[model samples]
Target: MLRTNIFTAWIYRLQHTDLSSKHTAVIAELRILLIDENRQRAESLTSALNNSRYKISHLASPNISLLKQVDEIQPDIIVIDIESPSRDILESVSTLSNYNPKPVVMFSADQNTDTINQYIESGVSAYVVGDIQSERVKPILDAAVARFKAFQKLKVELSDTKQQLVSRNLIDQAKRLLMKKKNLSEDNAFKAMRKTAMDTGQKLEDVAKTLISLLNTI
Candidate 1:
């Protein structure tokens, strides 16, 4: 019974602990760009975040140069509150995703499935459909940042995989060319390419590309 009570107390402390406070300096330095069409709700949100130590810049709409604003401000995160997102807003968000690529958190009253999917496709890290309460803001933003980092890591891994596949194909093509033209065995051709790569202090992929370029011309 005593062990159970101690375990329960430890779990409660863990659940109630504010882990974000450990990174208070980092959190305090984050810049948040807020976009909301409704002034009243924007004010409410700003008030709720007043003590959160985040630097915020509010914009009424993305009708202006949204790209320029993002570039100039260079915010760490973007928070959008709207009833229903317009086509222009999605376009702007898409542009940001392509060029700027900041973590985006969207709060909307629109419960349509298509609209929610559109927002996600436009690079919104977190899409909340309901009222925006004061206590939910920080947690939502933290989740958005986490999701964005995870997505970026996945993208990099995919890109690396694609490059590796291309390089492997190039190396195979070069090896086959050597086997055919130089009358070398398959293993010997690969060894010759590897030796040239090491001697020239260049990548095997680069040497493969050079071999292909020269052998194709001959």
Candidate 2:
């Protein structure tokens, strides 16, 4: 979390460092998608973002084919600037998170805190309210990317931890079932499980689960 805060603060500083130029070299050669119903606003954002050497694509509105468009474009980051973030729009953003899972920047003219939290939970890396500026684009994009990566790493770690717990539980359950059914000692039961796993070329957890399932059927 500290890393996220420091990275965000650094980006903010980068945005204000040079008032004359939109310093964007940090995010050069990156692909960006701009989703806005308002064509003028989209164009303005595109022009602003383009100055920083980022590739920009525009989506006029959220459609059923939004995911397909995303797959085709393969944007590194997604930028959404809408007057009001509608349900359909939010769903589209959620779908992006579920499917491609990129850093998303959502710029809303105004919104309540509840709706903002919903957006953040649903996958908006940076939820900005009020006017969107050209100078802040590069920094926000970089910060969003950093935050997304950190969150993704945490998610992967959590998933691995959960799987490990499940595996441990399965092994313990298998051992008890062995003791109850075969009258085997705990050490012998574990040895038998390890031996079976080695013989079948399967993981110990998988072998344990399979043995437990087989015994339950008998």
Candidate 3:
């Protein structure tokens, strides 16, 4: 019975796989900047993408600076199809990562470990080591979008956590200063800061910073 149940589940998945994977009907509602040296390949990929979902723009030349193009186009996502990425291409992507962050999908033939690592570090969200075909475009794009969103969420959380830590350290420093300057207990110093924050409609950290500055000047 267990074997039969397993077989039935496998059949169910096989039957529904195509239906579940198809994304043509769903609207992605994003602007995609496609960078492809080969015009023929670019057209093929554009045709494959859901017209209702993606607003597509193409850059047929390879030598143009990608950062400038991206700044002008301001696309939500970028897709690059290249045989092997050059140093200029990697540098452009790295600059884009620092300045204008967007999800990047690269379809490249080069599978060298160092090259792939460079691409990742340069902020390529999805890297495919094969031909850029129409049939595979949607799935690859979906994966790229998902990965990009997850990564962005983690980055935001990390930033918030770091800021909280810094604020906490500053508050602690201010509290220590207040305790020493006024000969107040730690609890009293914290209460005084909190009261000032509430009265002035300022944040506790802001009040702490002000207190620290004032105490230091004296």
Candidate 4:
């Protein structure tokens, strides 16, 4: 009977935890900057996106310095309508991706597959080719934003994982040193290390790193 009650409580907890995990707020309304050389085309694109959950801004010139304007607005996405790829525009996109959280999307009428691939590899998150339609713009924006957030989250998790692995390596090396220096069995050494960690109110990994550093100095 006790076992059955424990299982029921476990099931209840699992269901509620899964539901909580699914709840993430939709991204806030974004500021968007449209960069294109054609004034009419830029306006059309901006107009299409005006009613979106986005505040649209337009620039009719692809001047490299115009990126500073984007920084001031702190746009969530930068959409570049490229009639043709130029070195200056490519450099600007590369710089923006390295220095900012927001990702850039490149839309080209040229539809040159090789060029589009190059833009994507150069840090443009999404590459849309051909004429832009109002219906398609929002979905593309949504996907690019989602992809960028996922990449950022994965990067943070990877960094955390690397730190954990480094900590574990240090702990294991310290444990081995303790076994050899004290002429103690591995199990006994581990117990001593754990006890010391508890008494010092420090994490085992931290204690291990300190022990290893001390030994190295000696």
Please identify model 3 stretches exceeding 4 Å from their true place: 1-27, 62-69, 82-99, 111-123
Top candidate by TM-score = 1
lDDT of 3 by residue, 1-218 (tens): 11223223323433454565475566458889887777777777888885647778887764556657777778888877645354356545557467657787776655452234334333346566655667666755665665576678888999999999999998999999989989999999999999999999999999888888999999
TM-score of 1: 0.74
Query: lDDT ranking from best to worst?
Result: 1, 2, 3, 4
Q: Estimate, for each residue in 1-218, the C-alpha lDDT of model 4 and write its tens digit.
A: 11223223324434554464368556478988777787766766777787678788776664655757766777788777644454355455456577565677777676353233433333345677667777666766765665566677887899999999998888889989988777788898789889999999999999998899887787
lDDT of 4: 0.69
| Local error of candidate 3 at residue 156 (angstroms) | 1.6
TM-score for every candidate vs. truth?
0.74, 0.72, 0.73, 0.71
Clash pairs, model 1 backbone: none
Winner on lDDT (1 vs 4):
1
**Candidate 2's residue-wise lDDT over 138-213, tens digit each?**
6666666656766788889999999999999999999999988999999999999999999889999999889899
- Candidate 2 runs further than 4 Å off: 1-28, 51-53, 61-65, 84-98, 111-123
Once model 3 is optimally superposed onto the true structure by TM-score, how far is the C-alpha of residue 129 displaced, in angstroms? 1.5
Which residue pairs collide, candidate 3? none
- Prediction 2 TM-score vs. true: 0.72
- The C-alpha RMSD of each candidate to the native structure, in angstroms, is 8.0, 6.1, 7.7, 11.9
Give, for candidate 4, the lowest lDDT window spanning 10 residues: 1-10
lDDT preference between candidates 3 and 4, better one: 3
How many Å off is the CA of 132 in candidate 2? Answer: 2.4
